[model samples]
Target chain A: MMKSKHIPEEQLVDYLLGNIGEWDAKQIKAHLYHCKKCQYLLSDWQFLLSQDHKKFQPSQSMKDRIQHSINQMEGKSFKRRTVIGKPGLLFATIACVFLIFYSVHSYYQDINTRNYEIAENDEIPPETIQSAPHTQQIKVTPVSEFNQINGYVWVNRNRNEMLLEVDGLEELINQDYQLWIIYMDNSIDHEILPTQNGMTRMLFRDIDVDEFKKLKASVEPRGGSIEQTGPDTFIVEFQ
Target chain B: MSNDQENIQLLKDIAAGSRQAFDIFYEKYISFVYQIAFSIVHNHAEAEDICHDVFLEVYQKARQYSEEKGSIKAWLAVKTKSRSLDRLRKNKPLLIHRLENLSGSKKMEPGADLQFLHSLEKHLIVEALKAIPIEQREAIIRSYYNGETHNEIAMTMKKPLGSVKSLIRYGLNNLRKQKALMQWVGIDRGEKK
Candidate 1:
């Protein structure tokens, strides 16, 4: 069952590939404006599209020449035979092949240099796990199915702050474990924290302890799931 | 009746000596092949040349378009990519050979078949996609294959647009890095004592 409002993957693919008709394209465009899941699907599609539909364009004269060639072929009764006596075409192609290869090669080299410079200058923010716990903090323990669980949920009543820590688990790649505070009104997931050397800690701000009934942590897709709910890895009762 | 059938009929018209249909076809797919060629070749002039060459093939071989294999746009894309890569390997000078040998004996031509080149390029694409980080890979695939926009990617990834752009740039850079490695491997094997 399609529980979520996200457009199906099949329809998304067809829409992207321009296989769908005008009415469908309009409908999909409207859906896409509101659908983040379908939009994220584009990031994955960008490579093939970019690779397949490069940013390059043809010049006007080249277009005319191609059009001229088509005209000539049509004049020749559409024989499907190759054109001959156009040595200029061959030379033009040769010149293009050489110039483009040089430019693209050098252009990418320049980009790599720039990105390297950016990397060198870019500041690495302190890991969320390593952020210091605030002064006003309250402590609770998370219950995990795994027997080796060890972490404290420190909630600061004054600032509605919480610091979460867990040890003895491998830090996964392209996966995130997010903490959600389920209140009487609604549940909210806090920012993700990077784990290292089998340990993780994150400071959650704006926590309303009065309405907080339960806390949850779930391992989800890299950017976190579009849905607020997913498979829970750890749970804690605030009571 | 359908867009595909309409395209197939347009191709049939082009095959049967209709310059008007040829013009229509050219307008329909020029951007598809041109951008692909330019992106691969990275020169406007050269991309135009590839565009010319691509359409030239279509002009002569309109009859060969098959709905069974793929859409016309995809078919043109593969052709553009293979040609672009062939052009990318400028040191090889295969273009001259292809041009010189054009309309010559199929049995005697020294150049690799277009189909083989297409397969090779596809393989390279798959390998490059594999080598990139999953997050970056997913982003690229979504943008290109799924036809999602950068803003869409940003929203979906819960990332800023700048981050999304960076992911694509770095992902492509990684693909280039992997391309270099693959080329080195090819050279390594070629140079074995």
Candidate 2:
């Protein structure tokens, strides 16, 4: 159980250097939001960097080359604008608008459906998925017994996909849980969404599973699969 | 003109794809960018090339600039440093020689005054960083200069997620303390009053 209170020294360097990934960055961010000491420390480092900024000085030739490059790019852009023409531009604009509208509408609908499914799930909100306990196998229990949870399974209306994330999962290994988007009509096969490394939640969209009432997590071999040879590790049913 | 106001105007012109404004920006910050690059790369020619490439990237990606996220200076500094580091990593043999030369110089006396004010500033920063642990210094440098995210730092450093967070927290805390101390003992004589 790595308590959030103490961040390793190495990681602090990585975080300040912007070398950490999004998940870790988010975790650090959450920690920073709560930890004033860390926030002040970060601000101080930023100030140091700001002060260091004064030492930088470029040569005159470099300036000339950059100006030359910018000039060339501008010329190309001007040529492109002329080539595009009013009618061509108008058609392109219309096409872009139509595509954007279609994408947004479909995306919105998809998210709405995914959210509805997640909400109907009697299981805990996906956000509440904590860092799993470190073990060979993760026991997916209902949220009722765990500490406070913060998770979300909403659709990204723009992307037309359901984005699900369960933070605070106890770290576990060997046995990984696989997410299955069970569809209605029995015509569409169950879709297995990919899980991010060390992520406890799953998100999928563009799934027309309005009639599907359940989302299941099955224990699979390390790198999860479409096949569900293993038993259901966790089950969340839509109301 | 105030740096911030000039930056805002430059960014606006950049967003509009004005090459002249970009040239102005290049002129203004090229030296600063070069010095940082040279410090990391430790070579004049390569540093110049890196600076050129960084500015070119800025030109190409200017439209993507948004004031809400960060300032142009910060963005340029980050970009230049990352590119220089990447070059440094790729040319490890060269870096080894440079590092050897740097450590061998032994020109820096502990309490000696640096020639340029900028050198003094660098000395102070590096000294402050030294007061903290290496890991913290590494984290600060990577995050600030390399423009990497927290997870990337963890992966690169091969440390657990939690420890990385703490290192950054503690590192920053120590830095703040040093900064406060420095402010308290201002180099200026008037501060004695």
True contacts kept of each: 0.30, 0.21
Runs with alpha carbons beyond 4 Å of true place in candidate 1: A1-45, A51-56, A71-239, B91-193
DockQ (C-alpha based) per candidate is: 0.12, 0.10
lDDT of 2 by residue, A1-239 (tens): 12455443234445766666788878877877777656654553343243333444555566777676566544532332223457658878777768767865554344323332221121223342233232111233334433333344543333344545554433444444556655553322233322322344443434443455555666565334434656664545543
Best by DockQ: 1
Per-residue lDDT of model 1, residues B15-122, tens digit only? 665878988888888877776665444467777877876777676557656564457776676666655654544322333233223324345433323443344344
| lDDT, candidate 2, at B56 | 69
Question: What DockQ score does model 1 reach against the true complex?
Answer: 0.12
For model 1, the docking class works out as: incorrect
Alpha carbon lDDT of residue B144, candidate 1?
73
lDDT, model 2: 0.53
TM-score quality measure for candidate 1: 0.31
Error of 1 at B63 (Å): 1.5
